[model samples]
Target: MNIKIGNNNKISSSTIANTVNGNMEFPKKSWYEKHPIIGGIIVSVIAGVILIFSFWADIVKFIEGVL
Candidate 1:
């Protein structure tokens, strides 16, 4: 219950009240809650980036061939 810091300072844990409220609840939202089209576009862009990175060498080769 008691914690000692440097130079003989002691703090009792029993005195401190829990600041976080147990009654609080976070609102759950679906992916399309904000905006479906915009969310889809964002997800598509992220997936495209991941795919590009996954096959970067092939993409570079294709670009080089076209150029």
Candidate 2:
């Protein structure tokens, strides 16, 4: 967002912050938002955990057979 403050000066939306009660209000970015890849990583980790839990008996049986 390009805002024309004057005849020549241009201000962008990224540089703007709302101030309240003598405090600057900045946009809060979430951890996942900052690192988008983390979302995929988290989903993959959850799927891996679910798979491991679901196949726990089979894994144990295979390990026992191998032993």
Candidate 3:
């Protein structure tokens, strides 16, 4: 666009003003990553299962005696 200064003189829009912008894209996150509480709860449950299996000796003893 152009603006008239006087008679034959003129000025351009860009020369009078300027603008800058940055369009960016960020990596997407997984559902668990977006919800820390849920992810932590899941991890805690898995850890608990591991602990129970780790002490399977007690379970076997109780079962064999009842068998």
TM-score of each: 0.34, 0.36, 0.45
Give the Å error, residue 66, model 1.
31
Tell me how far the alpha carbon of residue 65 in candidate 1 is from the true structure, in angstroms, after superposition: 25
Q: Which is the winner by lDDT between candidate 2 and candidate 3?
A: 2
lDDT for each residue of candidate 2 in 2-28, tens digit (9 for 90 to 100): 766855775555545675476768999
User: Which digits, one per residue and each the tens of the lDDT, describe model 3 over residues 1-67?
Assistant: 9866856674445354465557777899999879999999999999888887746888888999999
Question: Each candidate: what lDDT?
Answer: 0.81, 0.81, 0.80
Clashes in predicted model 2: 0
Question: What's the residue-level lDDT of 67 in candidate 1?
Answer: 100
As for candidate 2, its clashing pairs are none
Clashing pairs in 3: none
Question: What is the TM-score of candidate 2?
Answer: 0.36
Q: Write the per-residue lDDT of candidate 1 for residues 1-63, one digit (tens) a residue.
A: 987764578555554566866798879888788688999999999988887775788888999
Ranking by TM-score: 3, 2, 1
